[model samples]
Target: MTENLKVEVVGLNRVKGKHLVAQIRLSNTGTEKHLSWAGEMADRTRPLGEIKWASGIGVLDAQARTWLLPYKPAGSPCLCSDRERDGLGQFINPGQSINVYAVLPAPSGNPATAIVVTPLAPPMLNVPISDEAPAGDFPDPDAEPVTLVNRRLILPAEALDKSEETADDGKDLQVNLSSDVLFAVGKADLTASANSIMARTARLIDASASTTVTVAGHADSSGNDAINEPLSLRRAQAVERALSALLTRSEISFQTQGYGSRRPLYSNDSDEGKRRNRRVTVTFAKPAPATREPVATTPPSVTGLTGTSKAEGQPIAMEIAGLRRLPGGLGLLTYEITNQGSAEARFAELHHAQDWEAYKYQAASNVRVTDVAAGRQYLPGRLEVPTDDGVDSYCACTDVSGIRINTEKFAPSQTREFFNLIALPETPGTLKVKIGPFRELDVPVQ
Candidate 1:
């Protein structure tokens, strides 16, 4: 029964100007298949598929008197029971819930009176927010349960002030992806496998859309500008070409620039530094301001809690610090491991890699948080391939041959750092991080 499901607005924000980021939740109430609500025409009759994804969703801002549909950019990677499309739907499992993010126009008005969530597409699943639940009307509880389908959520007025404020993550979206992953040495052609990743990146860009798309290319100082400059421009143009095809739905103006060994992010003195410098940054323009308004409320502060942990006789010291927020509702924590012992140690083994399925497991799993008051433990959020919450430095940078590429050695006095990104809690409290099978540290939230 689609009606048995409840919708909750977990997070709302006006980012990149004129854009709204809403994190919503859908909960299923019934345990049996009779009330199951699948989001598809074919599966609507079958209770087994549960909630088929690509279920259309729309948002209505009651105060501003406008409606917003789910934003899906073409060629974007989508996944809900494996059916993800750019600007399409996703799935929701039974008992458990899933979070869906949609970008829309920021609703106008102080204390938006109410916001409504409507499940579009399948008419049977549509829950129109009208009045209270009908008396003794359960809709058989097994058929297309249409009771309590529409969720009329009230919006906050104070947080919706009509004053100009900068977005929390900033106005523009910049992604600096390593060129090595997209091209071969000194070439502008994309690898065969890179196309899929580029498509996914396109969708991410569409998520934070803009009227202008700029692809800036950089190169290591291996060659002179006379040669490197053109190479860099070609690379940027290649990216522009791919993006142009993927963002056909958008009317974005495309531009490309080549730095040609200039403006290096890292000193191109070593191979690793060169790898870091040879990169392309895709910048998307923020929307033009519709009107000066309080874009959003101050987000919860993200700070690092410095502490140390060690395993007996391992001579390994971990300085877990450098905590910060990620794009979504995720936070990242870093652990710096220093080998104080007389011999070298493999960094992978120290991280309990044996139980980690050979670096295939998401690095965040090594971390679990506990709310001191509730005594409930929370796991990491959903992540894509190379599961480890590992930063690029820690995450596998395998070549086309599928070989593990990393620098995971910690010699005496040498230090290596690992990062874990996990879903964060609202009104953050004192959180204890369970790291590996060896150590635990408490982080008090402010």
Candidate 2:
């Protein structure tokens, strides 16, 4: 809820088999005050100077594992409601209602329903899809919106699966080799242990569609650029030379550079951050999307048992409220948390400490969903936001601010629902959901 605002989908219908026009109703349900939503729902990436628009509202195809942003033409803002032109002004007064709409790309496979994703509300699940053309005038009309809907799908990375040393963002794959693991201290010479690592890296590059690969070296902020730059470049050159010999592909080209102390992935204030900053990164394009269409699977709903746990020695009860399939190989896990103690309970350990800086106090980042059949575990979905230095990753699921009412801690006897958007593999049967301090539960895929 965006400050006592209740949203309802009026219609989510196809327009000439190309675009989905989402018609939504925003009601100020509060009796006391007027609600000002100065484009709170706009996508932060390209918000068009925050003039109040619904560009952020998108359709989350969980099965397809894609979020379709509002449709934008070659030289126009998004095909969504614009408060300035629509005369919607700024506020929704007490007991007033207004309508807004966004035109988005139709989900591939033309499923019967989609999950409507909003910035500050819970995912609106299983909204029925109609194939009919939109009725009445649009909030932002275009002469030929349907014809322009053929815009290519340049989607952001569908998922970012990160390991201890690698991060794959669906499009580009990066393998980060720690400088300490590959070289002698203050020198560019490869250690004896680097041979096996280089061999493994050659195989990864061999499997990609990349015609050019970049091997970039970095250094921590401890040293001045004069000392760090040349050393970093030497380290990159060594790695490049080793890869040149190891790679079997004859046409592959290597581009190497060293950014000494200029681009740090983590804050340079900590020991772990300094260690991570000292590294060589090999980056290449991932293989193209498979020609074969994505498998269509109906989302399943399964019941899970109530589980109990203690956080900070304070008793809390938890249970799976709902588990449903989302498009784009995703799962929407809804769970409930009840503070059973006499005092307010803070489930402080339930979040990923590393995510605090990007998503302050995210409540569900630590939740894991395991595909029982495939024996694969997935963390909550994440999106990487690029900064001046490097990329910062944050969970794609709901955070603590959206789940809690007034504070980070849960009041005694207060029960609130939490959601986690999980990256799931195409597996049948049950999935095991794990939350810290609570017993894992087997939830059937629906």
Write the residue-wise lDDT of candidate 1 on 144-197 in tens digits.
222111112211100011110111122454556668778898789988856865
TM-score of 2: 0.70
Minimal lDDT window, size 10, model 2: 150-159
Best by TM-score: 2
TM of each candidate vs. truth = 0.35, 0.70
Kindly list the per-residue Cα lDDT of model 2 for residues 193-233, writing each as its tens digit: 88877997888788788999999999999979998999999
Off by over 4 Å in 1: 1-169, 285-446
Worst 10-residue stretch by lDDT in candidate 1?
Answer: 156-165
lDDT leader = 2
- lDDT to native, each model: 0.47, 0.70
